[model samples]
Target: WRNTETSPETLSDSQLRGLGIVEGADGTINFESGIVVTGRVEKILRRDGKLMLIGFSNCSAKQGDRILFDPTWGTFDMAVGERISSVFNGAADKDAYNQIALVPKDRTIKVPSDENRKKLENLYAQVRDIRDRKVGCDRLGEIWETQQAEHAGDWLLSMQIFEILDEAGEQNDLKQKIVTFLNQKKLTNKDISTLIEWGFRLVTYHKVGLQTAAHGA
Candidate 1:
């Protein structure tokens, strides 16, 4: 009845008796073909560490139908359950499929509202104009170009541009404009942390440049 080597078709009468399967008895195979096959259990084999049920069915089963001994079996529902489990466990590859998961909820990047996006775009245009006119602000133009090429949606680059403009002794009017916009804009803690980190890195780079120039002098 449960021999690993016994073929389903070659099951003897004694083997059917051992499995308690009688001819015309109710047997269910959990598959896409959801029909109760009334037949005797021909043989059960443990192949690849899984129980393979071989039986003669009164109804014709399709070729690709998964044969199972019972409807309450775990493997029957594995396909549906695995998908749900992978999403919640964060084991699913985000790039592979566009599924939204509940766990690790904060991983999604919040896109700016249309009004905010328009404001940022306008600010970037003004910054570009300043870069074109200002002598020492060619670096700003390079940064803007890089942002446009790599991540046009990145609003943090605008903040960095404003910082650089203020450092370059730009007009008070522009500085005041930046300050007012920043005060009105609501930034997440993560955004604030990033700005602080970028500011520190900028300061360190400037210090290193000054040290190198002094050594050369």
Candidate 2:
């Protein structure tokens, strides 16, 4: 098990963008285990619509490293069978399998579709207008966070955001909290409806934003 909350957020713009992959940028990365490593990015591969294989070359762990990657689930394992890669003393880059970090894929709850994308965009446009108000709009941030889901390449996180809001909306206490927020902000019933409708879309279609580009899904 590893922790990512404290993982060094330091990475290049490209490395930090989208999936925050560490390849193509020459530098060291600090994992939650506090193990620091430096290497050249070998491959930036996506798998199963939700994870990436961050591969590196000439990699080294701290003087005494404890990080370990299992070999069974990666293409690197096949390299050994083909006899193209080798391992020495369990070194991290002894072969292909040792050099990859399976980074989590960030995307929406459902694979984005053209129809859902347009509806979602229109809904967010309205949501954004509501957020521009002075009060009762903190609830609007939930919708804004969904935009982050699209950028992070993890729609599941986006879906979870909507899920939390939906759960809160179902409960009287939580729903009242949101209602009071809108009242304080002087937002209208239509505003509340838009917020509720956004959640409904998530529960129904589960889209964060329109997928403007094609990603290997």
Candidate 3:
């Protein structure tokens, strides 16, 4: 981890790539004994063929501990206490160092069924039409992007788009579609509770807006 006092809260993609740290690469700190500490690499600093990994561990590590990089699960055996240096040296000798490059696992894109795809396309078209008619409704564009994200297997963004639509007083077919989507999803109890809370907030916001309008009139 970079120094919080000096470094920004988040770094750009280029900066992360420059550090050779793929955010969620799996690693382990193995002791000489049979004990193993599992962790995910947050940041890496490389200097003269040496690497310094900063990450959160399942348990505390003692000084002089080194991590074994295993981006692929079965690439390194923790029982053997294989360090990153030894793995890198061996790879260098074999001229196959690219095989152990730190990178995120390939994500399999979820392809929606034909019916769902048509529905999404229609929703996107409707949002685009609304944008073309309305001059300053930025939330519509955000809704379109969120819908695309949800279709791409990021269902968490649905709540955000829901809140945006509700706040914009758009309780039309688009809002209904979002509600239906949420209902069909396997949401946790906390997620359901949060949706209810957002509903209450929307009601309160509308009530406040109505009262303010009446007073102004």
What's each prediction's clash count?
Answer: 0, 11, 0
Candidate 1 on 1-217: residue-level lDDT in tens?
A: 1322454334455654454555455443332223223343434433344433343433322223322222221111111112322322222222111121111123255444666555545545655556456665655655555545644445344555665666576655654654554444325445334333433444455556656778999
The C-alpha stretches of model 1 lying farther than 4 A from their native spots are: 1-105, 113-116, 135-158, 170-191, 207-211, 214-217
Span of ten consecutive residues with least summed lDDT in model 3: 89-98
Candidate 3 deviant stretches above 4 angstroms: 1-157, 167-171, 184-186, 189-192, 199-203, 210-214
Better of 1 and 2 by lDDT: 1
Q: What tens-digit string does per-residue lDDT give for candidate 2 at 7-102? A: 222323353443333546554455443545555556654434322344556554442333232222222111111111111111112211223222
Better of 1 and 2 by TM-score: 1
Model 3, residue 145: C-alpha shift (Å): 8.9
lDDT of 3 by residue, 85-199 (tens): 2322211121111122222122132445666656555554554455446544555655656565645443434544454466567656666776666665535344334434434
Measured against the true structure, the TM-scores of the candidates, in listed sequence, are 0.29, 0.24, 0.28
Candidate order by TM-score, highest to lowest? 1, 3, 2
Model 1 TM-score, all chains together: 0.29
TM-score (C-alpha) between model 2 and the true structure: 0.24
Model 2 stretches astray by more than 4 angstroms = 1-22, 63-217
